[model samples]
Target: MNFAKPLPNYLVKRYHGWKATTYSENQVWYRRLATEGQRPRAMVISCCDSRVHVTSIFGADQGEFFIHRNIANLVPPYAPDGDHHGTSAAIEYAVTALKVAHLIVLGHSQCGGVQGCIDMCKGQAPQLEAKESFVGRWMDILKPKFDLVADVEDSTDQARQLERQAVVASLENLMTFPFVSSAVEAGSLSLHGLWTDIGEGGLQCYDPKEGKFSEV
Candidate 1:
């Protein structure tokens, strides 16, 4: 495919403006981050949703976190497959190579994938065809928990429960990785489950002691 194209006027201006201020205003940060390859303290596995940006939420600058984003932010149990494993590979690098101190599985409210999965499980959504959609296969990872927690009396309640279940399920699956397991066992690494509500602007954390998520 033919490549060069005129830059958008606004983008060109923004790029030049950033460049002008970068070395003087942002030099200290750039120097520190560039001194070494990424040496992040945490790795965040988050949804591919644009609104769910991890670094911005945590006010982190470059190289502060090793991030992996995918549809629904699901971490499927490690398996040898020919298919792309972008998220898995990110995890491997962060845990084994970078040796991040913590791993956070970040899930959020109003997650379309989780809602779609709930609808599919309740027979309200269209059946999946392998040739056309991996929805069925992707959500299959959350099936049992969704079924266990489905709200029979209220549809809205069922949706809320499904979102929560997704977070818990992913956290459990995260530990299935041998590196994660070893780190947790040796107290070198820790796992945290977090849920973000965009509308509420609240960050709730899962509390195993109370078996419920509480506001952070």
Candidate 2:
């Protein structure tokens, strides 16, 4: 309970710098945003990786996108068993409340979470398979897709395939929500699956008809 601490000096300095420049230059816009609230056109569900800068990658300014970051960017099937569902909560808010038109699940290359899932599935990380591990439990959402890439012998290729599959899995899970499915059926909301290569800065989009991802 007493673990809270003041901001670090480096972060405080950076905050002051941004406040003096970006905030000062856009003071009116910032005030308007505070008064009017966010009205983003899209909802982005992405991995909680520091390198995955959703806003920066899309050249989005503040309040342009509703972004939710979770480990592996996995969305579980609609489970309304009264247990807390952070990703589902965000999806509900974005779909029903914000009425975002596009729901994007952004997966990326060299994801640590994906690697963890691979290791756990391969029996290389028994710690992650422990019942008490939060990550292990959360990663169970993607375990079903692991078998699709299990036959691939190349480590790099297998990882890449699974990474894209994560996005596909999340997109599939998104439709399980009644609100999302209804919105999609009504032509109000659309779902997209995207994968990015971190080192190469390349992007790919999933084509449901082709059942594959192609470069964007």
Best by TM-score: 2
TM-score of 2: 0.99
lDDT against the true structure, per candidate, is 0.81, 0.96
1-216: candidate 2 lDDT, tens digit per residue: 899999999999999999999999999999999999999999999999999999988999999999999998999999999999999999999999999999999999999999999999999999999999999989999999999999999999999999999999999999999999999999999999999998999989999999999998
Quick one: best lDDT, which candidate?
2
Candidate 1 lDDT over 1-216, as tens digits, reads 569889999999999888788656988778877886678999998888888978878999888898888767788877657788776788889889999999998888778888778877777777642435776778778778876666556866766667777778888887888887888999999889888887777898888789788889
Q: Distance (Å) between predicted and true CA of 77, model 1?
A: 1.1
TM-score for each candidate, following the candidate numbering: 0.88, 0.99
Judged by whole-model lDDT over C-alpha atoms, candidate 1 comes out at 0.81
